[model samples]
Target: MRTAKRPLQSQASEAQKQAALRYILDAWEEALHDGIEPEMLANAALFAALADLIDLYGEDAVAKMTTGLSRRIHHGEFTLRRTAQ
Candidate 1:
């Protein structure tokens, strides 16, 4: 009997995603070690980092900061990306 294949998003169990994310993140870390400032990181990594930070700092502080940030965004107090920079 032929078995079905899973989509890449859910394929290779956990190892594939972990390996790709680890490779990308290690490049960022190596850049920092080499005194280079990365202009951007993947959104997935950012979300993970935020979750890790919240775990480290607890909910209250991170929540307060995000709430304030949202308030600033609502008030037009922060810069946003443009269509063309």
Candidate 2:
């Protein structure tokens, strides 16, 4: 028998999300210390992320989802540091 699959967002709790980010950040810092360039790490990370997303959600759906990223980015949703203007 086939089991039903849960939606991606419903699969992880908010705390799980934070923990996941922490783990990724730790690995990122470790890679930096091991002499990997940030740009190279970023490119690999993006490629890995997009490839996994496409595998799970398909290229069209992933493309549609990422279309809003431009607006979100412009709004500084991903900004971690800000300087006084």
* Whole-model lDDT values for every prediction: 0.60, 0.80
Per-model clash counts, in order, read 0, 0
Models 1 onward score TM values of 0.34, 0.82
lDDT at position 49, candidate 2: 90
lDDT of 2 by residue, 1-85 (tens): 2222323344678999899889889999999999999999999999999888777766766777789999999999988679899
Q: TM-score of model 1 relative to the true fold?
A: 0.34
Q: List the residue pairs that clash in candidate 1.
A: none
